[model samples]
Target: MTDWAAHEGRCLIHLLPDVITLFHEYVQRNPSDPESGGILLGTVHGPHNQVVHATPPFPTDRRTRCSFDRGSEGHTEVADQFWRESSGIIRYIGEWHTHPEDYPSPSGIDLREWKISAAKRTDGRPVIGLIVGRKAIYIQSTSATGKALVYQALLGNCPALGH
Candidate 1:
């Protein structure tokens, strides 16, 4: 189970509208063609479904160790923008990326990389791993059974640092 509380106080789990906005933005924001990506975030206030506060997509560049590897080094500007755009009412929470595949989940290598990311943080924030593609967002965590559907509203803020 990626702890729903994993990234507490550090990042935001964006809502559907916000998620969709990022999806569209990424596809158009970068000239990298298939290489472009963006971040998704929202302030999750819940009883299961509510948004007392929100944020928008913060654009960032994709950094990969190998050009073919589906991974990146997220830029700081994205996080900074979340603060700036949200009027200081929100902060960084997690990020999302797209894969050419209709379904994008963390690849084996992607999982390895996430572990490294989680290890570097001292704030106990949940580093969200989102794979957006084919009109769907799949959620994966330390305890997820398979792909958790974003459309179904499966997870919000999980506490699993990373698998």
Candidate 2:
């Protein structure tokens, strides 16, 4: 198992080996077609959130060649189950999705949605958004104060990012 740390000293988001494997499998399932996505579930430690698990694409999700609208159906139930199973340690930390591009960048709508989500969060912890592109994965952590820090994947097997 390996970990990736954000450049900014303020926040660190950990992507566990299983989570990484799941993301890669999801991307490989549909290399260049419709988008798929789900919520990020994990535990928050001071100044860091370790992403232990990520929900698979929901059955009700709306997918297209260029966009994905994650369905909320059964999401709350799944989250609640995770919370109970984890002894209330695991909770909704943020969101994640697949992008068709080789190196994905968040669209305007993505940023807007993330901002709104962050603002609405009552935990005061940053929300982590992940985009799994064909060649690489992008991660961003946005604080309740609206400060966002981009993270780089440190694992050698992961594709290198330009920015």
Candidate 3:
């Protein structure tokens, strides 16, 4: 796992190797695509949020030169299965998508979507948002308390931090 401190060290974000691998493969497979993304799943422990799993882009996902719309087709079923298999340990935590820029930053749409997702959280916990860019990957966590912290990506055994 890779750890990142946010909110001036108030929150810790951990990215698992598996999730990183998934993102790598997805990006490699669609090297020329403008955007691609899916769901993020994991568990939360106190001030630490661990992301351990991620879904591949759905077949029905809408992709464009600048945006990615995660399709819902079969998503609920997959999330339910993951929750059940983990014995309620893992749950839907956030969303991740790709950007064509070297250092991608969230757009207005991204911020709005994150706020909506945070507001609907049943556990009142923050929802993570990730953007995989050509050079670096950006991560953010937003909570019900209106705190949104951007995390610094920590690459663990991954070829490069900004790959």
Cα distance off (Å), candidate 3, residue 120:
1.0
Higher-TM-score candidate of 2 and 3: 3
Q: 1-163 in candidate 3: lDDT tens per residue?
A: 6677776677887888888777776552244665888888888888788888888888888988778998869566778898999999999999999887777799989988998989999988888999877666788987766578888744452224344
Backbone collisions counted per model = 16, 0, 0
Residue 41, candidate 1: Cα error in Å is: 3.7
Q: lDDT at 70 for candidate 2? A: 82
Q: Could you give candidate 2's per-residue lDDT for residues 1-163 as a string of tens digits?
A: 4455776455667777778777776673354568878888998888778888888887899988788898869667788899999998999999999888878888888887888889898887778889988778888888767687888766564643322
Which TM-score value belongs to model 3?
0.88
Per-residue error at 72 for model 1, in Å?
A: 10
Clashing pairs in 2: none
* Least well predicted 10-residue stretch by lDDT in candidate 3: 154-163
Candidate 3 positional error at 41, Å: 0.4
Residue 109 in candidate 3 has what lDDT? 94
Give the whole-model CA lDDT for all candidates, comma-separated: 0.42, 0.79, 0.79
Report the lDDT of model 1 for residue 29: 26
Model 1 stretches astray by more than 4 angstroms:
1-16, 25-33, 44-74, 84-89, 141-163
